[model samples]
Target: MIFPLTVDRVFADRTRAEIGRSVLTVPAPDGTHVVLGGHDSTGPEDGYPIGVYATPAGEGRAPGLADDLPAVGWLRTARPLRAAAFHPVLPLLVLGTGSYDGGYFFEGALVLLDLASGRRRDLFADDCLREVRSLQWLDAHTLRLLLAPHDDWEDRAARSEGHLVDLTRSDWRAVPARSLRPEDLCGPRVPALLPQPTPPFATPDPESPRPGHIRSLTELPDGDILLTADHALLERWSAAGDRRWSLPADPRLSGGPLAAVAADGASAWVEARGDWRRESGTFIRIALTDGTERERHTTPGPAGLLVSSGIPLLVPVPAGYGELSRSLFRHGRHAVFRDTPRAACTCDCPWDDDEECACACACPLCAGDSMDDEEVWLTVVEADPAADPTRLAFPGTERRRQICPWSWEPGETHYDGPGVWIGETDLVMATVRYDGAVRVPKQGFVTRRPIGEDPSGTPRWVFPVDRTATALDIDPSTDTVLVALSDGELIALDATTGTLRARGHVHVHGVPVIPTALTVTGPGRLLLGTSDGRVLTCRPGPG
Candidate 1:
């Protein structure tokens, strides 16, 4: 019933290279423009595929960039681009770059280029970041940024945090992040965009019931809320908003962030994380009544544990790697170069500026056998634990279906990795992978599928559009899907037929608002966490 897959990373890269996605062109205040280039798939021999090209603004539009600006500046990086833009009115340009630790998060740099002097400096040139995910020029004097977490070992990974830079201040200093409204994105004189945060949950509460590592939120038979917090902590809350009791989080047992938690007829099944730093982890059994450890075992985990039938099922994911970044069964090692010893080779990717060539190693263990060492694949194996841990396969072919089997199809795109379950049986997915002839992760699709017996299931309907979806949530009451796009657009779609229901560029206090966290509260009501780390609650009108 599981569809295990081994994505040919190298072959995938070569395919992307052949596609050669085009660059994005944004106009400056003047007639001149800024072109943010694409990433190169072949190798880092030339540099990271990202580049910044400026064209000379003559009396009119320059006919040809190649002839006019023969020498476009290249910003070859091993990391990827999170945000790139030109200063509102200055000759300086800025970009945010980072490597994806996993999923949509990245670790990287805030690079600034002085076009007049042709000198560049990385604003956040430190080694501590995943990447600069959001960047904006509030004005010529100020810039704002939202940095991705460098690691996902704790609660910080789920929250959006940002930094403010005042050109007025010479050196970098951390400042509290301020939410943006519509006027902020389009620049001065625009009307205030987003509404204020809804009452109650809008304000901050330092001492409030802040729960981390929310592995699962379940309701007991009597209407009580059973919430599993981070570090193996569990709490029972009354429907009246009272904290009934919290179980002890013993350090001796597994106390890291839990992956999943479930309650059966008697005991609760919890997947506890280990102190991956020590390369050690364990699964522990607890007695629901006394809150005492019944039994525990050491394993290659920081895994998700559950009880199926009578046997214990443990899902060991790629741990110690950034969230959503690791493989299901890597033997604590990545694919090494075929021609070199694990010692002779840095194992670092060339794009990251490694001085060696991989000739592309494709390790089934890590999918690096052919992909760049820096590339990480998204794979999951759902099955019973094997006596010999070496045997593992994700999305196994049996009972499996290739949702979007054909890459570069005429109208379809690739699966965007993660998706949400509609109600309990259906799924809603978004992607940016079609064969539109553009090299960019352009308008993809948000599709729905009715899963029954097959894993290679086809979508019931496909909603095609010009935006790359970043997140999605379904409103059961309204029968609509809320899609968060990378470009700061919040939209609603007809859930049943895959049609557009509503669309808008949400903004607060003149700054356009996008969402990093989306939760459908009830009916037409929803909560949105902005890229700037701010929050807003609203209901989109019907189409």
Candidate 2:
């Protein structure tokens, strides 16, 4: 049975229709507010036409392009500006460019404009920084920059470096930085946000390596553990604690069977994800007898976030703007000529999401941008294993679907709710619980409810946990519910009563690991993957 969901409560923090845009604050040097309005559609292709203009602050005048608006000193560049600000004490302006148009994998650069003299200095130092994601003018002569690489590049590791630019000498130097695996230095989105923040103007050890921890783990009926690795590999461990089988070790993909797994008596359905270089992924029917691929089903590549339960494969459908942004990025990478809108939705809500962006203006720039013509909805996609996942659905509304609160909320430093999991006949949802503007810490809850004939009602029960659960499993034989928290803790609870049973930590290959995912793989076992690239198994106790 399919049950519908709704938003229990809503809180929004917004000023103007700001979504994919930034507000530039310039001193104006004369008390007037200097506004360099960002174009909702500007990027690498169309370029950024950043101009400085002074507007009296607190005026009711909405920000936009008007014929009467005066341009003081303007800087035109083919690169999109990620951040820009005028120097507080000097006649200089600083702009930062991110990895737009698939530029992150290679390098990112910075630009400095002498507003008074109109002299521009383009800087690309250290040969690193695929994108300068964040920038701030530390002083009249010092600029601080945060640098990062793309999400799925070279190794399983991610690096963050800080740069201090000397405006006086027109040079830059490295500063104290933190280099860790990409998983730990994550941003609000998948594949991690470029330019993870680091301490500015100071020196920290730059050597960092975020080891490939476990990605996904599930227990088999025979008490075996089936796990995936961040390096895109899969393995099976028998009940006797021996390596049963492993997939072809592809160093490039370093992927695991992350989407979902459906195990039958003698066979299993596994999501065989490939590298981003491909346009599709394959679903393999593996024989439990020897762990060989028996049957194969091919679906679109970048099926990066997949969740399945044998019958239907569920994918997290990016709301309209996200889809378009991703599409543009992909096209930009492939030189596909998106021919889409250059302006983006300034309101946090996508322009097409009328409910959220009721005040969104359908301006000429937006109209001319080809992508602005269509609407994208937030909904769960039901993909057929026999066909490509090209369809989406909404149970309650036409344009929007029920959303997980923690997923897209603005204040969320950590984003959860990536997929919809259907474990056996029970639906498991691990989400955060809030109290007003203050989020109740470690109060994340795991709500489970068996799919009943009624199709609509309250959950079976909701139990609180220490952090947002990364994985949930229901052990039918023992009637146990296993939840994995982000901090790598596993909590066992009674499925029927939702009472605390037992809690413990998981270790893989003798090292304590941060649990990435979990599943009840066998009769008396729970399987979990950690952040350090190991698949470990555990036996929980009854509390």
RMSD to truth, every model: 19.2, 21.5
lDDT by residue (1-543, candidate 1, tens digit) is: 001111111100111121123333344556565444443332222224444444465644422322334224444444655567677766766776655556544457667776676566655424344355556777666776655443445635333443333233332222212222222323212121111212221222344332222333444556444444342345455545455665645554433322223324344544454343222246555444445555556554333443222233443343332232211111111110101111112223333223334446442323234322332222222333332222212222331222223222433335332255664456666655635464343657777765443444567788776655545677777777787765556777888898776677654322243344455556766555433323344555321
TM-score of 2: 0.39
- Compute each candidate's TM-score over C-alphas: 0.39, 0.39
Query: After superposition, which runs of candidate 1 have C-alpha atoms over 4 Å from their true positions?
Result: 1-221, 226-236, 245-298, 301-313, 316-368, 371-426, 431-445, 450-460, 463-473, 483-490, 503-543
lDDT of 2 by residue, 1-543 (tens): 001111121111011111113334434545443535333322122234455654535663423422234445555444445566666766666667665445226344566667567667665544434455566766655665555545435534444433323233333222112222234323332232443322221121243112344556656656666666554355677656666766643444444435234423565555544443232244555666677766666543223233322332423222222121111000010101011223332333233433333444564333433543332222332334454322221122232232222222244322233122344344455655444434224567676544332234246777766566666666777776677676556677776787887776543211223556665545765555554344444554322
Compute the lDDT for candidate 2: 0.44
lDDT of 1 at 373: 35
Q: What is the alpha-carbon RMSD of candidate 2 to the true structure? A: 21.5
Model 2 misplaced stretches (Cα beyond 4 Å) = 1-211, 219-224, 249-252, 257-269, 272-316, 319-426, 432-443, 449-457, 506-511, 521-524, 540-543
- For model 1, where is the 10-residue window of minimal lDDT? 3-12
